[model samples]
Structures are given as structure tokens and as C-alpha cells.
Target: MLDVKAQSIANLRAQIKAIEEDSGAHGRSEARSSQCNGNASRAQRPHRRYGTAIDAQRNPASLPCGCSVLANSENDKQRFSQAKQTEEERDQANSAFAKIQRLLCIREHASALLYKRLLASGYEEHIASEAVQRAIDCGLVSDERYADVLVRSRLSQGKGLRGIAFELEQADIDPHNVPAYQEARFRDSGPDELARALSLLAAKPPKAKRVREAAYRKLVQKGYETDVAARAARIFAEQHDSVAIETR
Candidate 1:
């Protein structure tokens, strides 16, 4: 039995030696065949492609072609597909960013043009209304506080309700709020209003035979009623001379 075992071992060794010799010869033959076939051409080289055979072999599903430079397994295919999808998503995101950047480059000038056209054309009254709202939201303007300040300033400058209302209307302010602003901002014998009216009378005393006519026109332009202008003129005359007032 011992001799038999020794013989078997010797036979195995001889078989391995023969197999190694045959493998070496086969490798030489394969190299010769590759060279003769011009497989190493610059264009035919694996480097010419984007990914190596190893990468394809690792991700067979992503390869799209049945060529494997890498000894990768089926599991690698799923991973490669996921990675490719991620790359695509990133590229799309980059493209979107570029588009937004281009649009924003002209955003400021476009916004101004839109505002001018909207007001001038009077398409819907506040054509840039949406833009104004967005501006306010973005802190470019304030509607509430601005309304209060503007009304106050106009009233102080001797502008009557009619004049102020007209101006505010032109500015696309809501009419409903205009009345409220007028009521809140001015009252009977308002100091600001009285001062403004007094200034108008003082600027040029009605001198022409059209003196009264001129005063009336001025008062009307200032947004005062005929009655209010007459009353103010009478009161003003009593206090000073050469100052005439009338209303239309």
C-alpha cells in the first residue's frame, strides 16, 4: 500500500510538469497570434475607449457591449448602473444651473422694462403688479409702511384728497385703501393741508382780472373744492392781504 501511494504521487508530479510546459507554449502562441493580428494598433488599443475592460467586466449591465477588460462579476453591473445614473443626474443639475444663471444675468434690466411698459401701456392697471408684489416680498419695496408715509408726505405738501387720490391711483394703489388713507391722514382744518393751501395763495396773489380765475384753477389743480377754497381765502384775507383764494 505504501509503494502504491508513492507511485500515485510521482504520477501527479509528472502530470503537473507536463501541464506547465503546455501552458507556457500556449501563452507564447497566443502572444504571437495577437501580434500578427495587429491587435495592438493605436486605434484598436483598449485605452482608446472611455472605460477599461475591467470596468466593463465589473459592470456588465452598464457596458452596453459584451466586452470585458476587467474580471468583474454580475454584482458589479448593478453598482456601475447606479453610478452612471448618478453622473447623469449631476450633469442635468449643472445644465439647469447654467440656464438659471443666464436668465438672471438679464433679470434687473428686464424687471425695469417690464415695470415701465406695464405702467405706460396700462394693460390691466398694475401690469407689473406681480413684479411689485415679488419685489415687496424680496424686500425691494414696502406696501403698508410706504402707503402711510406717502399719504402723509402728500398731505403735508398741501395736496387735497382729490389730488392725492389721483396720484395714488396712477401709482396703481387700491382705491378702497385710498379713502381709508385720506380719512386717517387728513381731518377738518388739518395743519399740513392749511399750510399747503396758504403757500399756494402766497406764491402769486391773483392779480389778473382772471385773478379769481387763476386762483380757482390753481385751487382745483391742488385738489380743493370751490367751497373749501373760498372758505380758506376768506379766512386767509382776514389774517393777511394781497392773498386771494377761490375754488372751481
Candidate 2:
């Protein structure tokens, strides 16, 4: 009985040792599986430091601290600002052109005059100049034509060539074109200067006691050259004396 009891006690000790070994082995296997699952989860998770996947694709030079996102936003803002400024400039140019058209419709203007008008009406310098150039290109404005018309008008009003030339210069007519217009109108198709001067003197003779001097002064004031004025005065005085003698 004592031997059996000792054998049973030894058997129970062996079974307990076997059970403890199996539990330890199962725990080690479960620990390894848990470690593998954790590694996989970490590998599948996205990195938050680089922003979204799309953002990373767009900016390959992205920094770890996310500075690339700010740079991209700034670049987008700059592009938008440039586009807005371009649109505003285009609108201003169109408005300037419309103003020029209205001014031309009312009456003729020299290119310089038109530009000045636009400035006086508060248009920007570049806008005014562009509008004026457009008008000139489209044949709406012409310095040559303006000069010619002014010369004709002044002549009809009994203004001398020198006076008309000065007026043309003031009106911004080109210096080269001024002489051309003068030669065309006076030398080619207009009345002789001397005849015009004499005719003026005859119509309105001097009433002063010194007739020749007075007539010369009057003709000079009317824009004739001194030489032409003197000759016209002398002829008029002689004609007056002869007429007086005939009446007596």
C-alpha cells in the first residue's frame, strides 16, 4: 500500500509538470501571433506628417514638417491675383476706347488733343495714349487733316500765314506737315498773299492823318510780311492822292 501511494504521488507530480509546460508553450505561440498582427497594422496605417496621399503626389518635394502645403497655397493665390489684375486692365482699356469714340463722334480732334482730353476726363496716361493710338490707327483722328482745315478756316477769317502757322503749332500739328499744308493751300489752290492784303486795305482804308504808316501798321497786324505791307500802303496812298486831285 505504501509503495502504491508513493507511485501515485509521483504520477500526479509528473502530470502537473506536463500541464505547466503545455500552458507555457501555448502562451508563447499566442504572444508571437500578437506581435505579428501589431507589425502589420503599423505597416498599413497612413503617415500623418505628409498630409493626404494626393497632396504628397502633387508635391514630391514636400518637407516632413508640412511646409509644401503652405507654399502651394501661396502659389495659387499669386496666380489668382495676376489673373484678376489682367481682367481689370482689359476692362479699363475697353472703357477708354469707348470714351474716345464718343469724343470723336461729337467733333474732330487731333491725336494729341484727344489724348489730352482723355487725361482731363480722368483716364490713366497709358489708357489715354492707347485709346488715342487706336483712333489714329482706325483713321478717326488725323493731325494732317486737322491742320489743313484750321488753315483754311483762319485764311477765310483774314488771318495771315504766320498767324495761322502759330495756331497750327499750338494745336499740336506736326511741324513738317504744317508747311506742306500751307504750300498746298496757299501756293497751289489759294489766293495770292499780296492781293489778299491789298484787297483788305482797300475795303477798310486807314483813317489816320499818316495814311501810309497807318495802312502799313494795319496790314502788319493782319499777318502780312513787312515788305508786302509797305508796298500795299504806298500804293494805296498814291491812289488816294490821285483820286483827291481828280475830285478837285
Candidate 3:
């Protein structure tokens, strides 16, 4: 009996040792499977990280906080610069207008002359042009009226029609209107050239020895037509000779 009991105890000890060995083998297999799964997940993690980095690079707006603020700041700066420029132009325009008013108060100016004056006074081109146009709209500048006055004044000063026309051109009068001004001065009950030539001779008779020739030359110089000057010189010579005979 003692031997049988000892043998049974030895068999039980062997069975326990075999079960422990099996458990250890199963545990090792499970650990290896978990390690493989972890390695695969780690490999996929790098790919996910790389894809996320690519997306961020492609779209800057996707950046968390600063990008949108910077864009808005740039837009604001541009708008402010534009506004400031507009304000400066407005002030310049106002200054130009005031200068125009003061000049008009002093004397009438042709639009072209006023524009040149404004530029000389340091106004911007566009601003000066606008101011001059405004003056025209207000009727503060009238080329027609100025031309009328200038024509009469020049004629009274012994300027010939051709010389007066040249002065008008220098004053920026339209060439097409020159004929109209001439007609108004000479044809509308105005002073005729022949009468003007006679009057000029009466005022300052020729003192040269060749009286007729000197008279004719003087009338021509005073802006009379050649035929008119010749007729006046002949008539004046005859009248002077008759007066001398009466004196003798």
C-alpha cells in the first residue's frame, strides 16, 4: 500500500507540471499576436500623420488661429490707404476751387489761361481742370464777352483787323468765331475802314515832302485796306492843295 500511495503522488505532480508548461506556451503565443497587431497600428499611424501634414500644407486657412487674422489685416491696410488717397484728392480739389474763385474776382480768364495758372500755382492737373470746368458752369468765365471787349479795345488802339485776329488767337479764341467778331465790329453800323482811314489822316496829316505817298503809307500802317488808303490819300492831298491856294 505504501508504495502505491507514493506512486500516485508522483503522477499527480507530473500532471501539474504539464498543465503549467501548457499555460506558459499559450501565454507566449498570445503575447506574440498582440505585438504584431501593435506594430501594424504603429505603421498606419505614420501614414495618418503624413496625410494630415499634407492637408495642412495644401490649405493655409486650415491653420488654427493666425492666418485669417493676417489676411484681414492686409485687407484693412489696403482700404485705409485708398481712403487716405481719396481724402487728399478731395482737399486738393477744394483748394483749387478757392484759388479759381479768387482769380475770377480779380479779372476774367479764359478757361485755358485759368487752367495754366492753376497748374503754375501747384494744383494737380485733374483738380485744376475740374475747378476750371466748374467756373465755366457758373458762367464766371465767358470767352464771347471777353472777345467782344478785346476786339473793341484793340481796334481803338489802331490795331488792324488782321492784327486783332492774331491777338484773339493768342488769347485762345476759336478761329471759327473770328469772322463773326469782325462782322459785328465793321458791318453792324460800326466804324467802316474807309471812314477810319480818313479820320486817321485828319488827325495826323502827312508832313513828308511827298504828301500823298506818305499819307497812303501811314493809312496802310494803321490797318486800312490798300484801295481805301489810296483814295483817302488822294482826297486829302486835293483838300490840302485847295487850302494852300486860299492861304496864298
| 1 versus 3: better TM-score goes to | 3
Q: Please, what is the TM-score per model?
A: 0.40, 0.53, 0.50
Q: Lowest-scoring 10 consecutive residues by lDDT in candidate 1? A: 239-248
Please provide, for model 3 over 178-240, each residue's C-alpha lDDT reduced to its tens digit, 9 standing for 90 to 100: 655557455958667666667778888889978889998987776666787899889988888
Question: How do these models rank on lDDT, best leading?
Answer: 2, 3, 1
RMSD of each: 14.7, 13.8, 15.6
Kindly give the number of clashing pairs for every candidate. 5, 0, 0
Off by over 4 Å in 1: 1-130, 175-180, 183-196, 203-207, 233-248
For residue 48, model 1's alpha carbon misses the true position, in angstroms, by 15
- Provide the overall lDDT of each model, using Cα atoms, as 2-decimal numbers: 0.58, 0.76, 0.76
On the 0 to 100 scale, the lDDT of residue 55 in model 3 is 47
Candidate 2 segments exceeding 4 Å error: 1-72, 175-190, 198-248
lDDT for each residue of candidate 1 in 1-248, tens digit (9 for 90 to 100): 99999999999999999999999999999999988777657444556456456446544565554445432455665666888888965554444334333444553222333355545644333324554445545554544444566666766666666676665666566645755465744556545455566677776555555444556666678887666666666655654534333321
User: Could you say which candidate leads in TM-score?
Assistant: 2
Residues 6-95 of candidate 2: C-alpha lDDT, one tens digit per residue: 999999999999999999999999999998998897666656763465464454345354455544665545655787888987888889
Ranking by TM-score: 2, 3, 1
lDDT of 2 at 192: 73
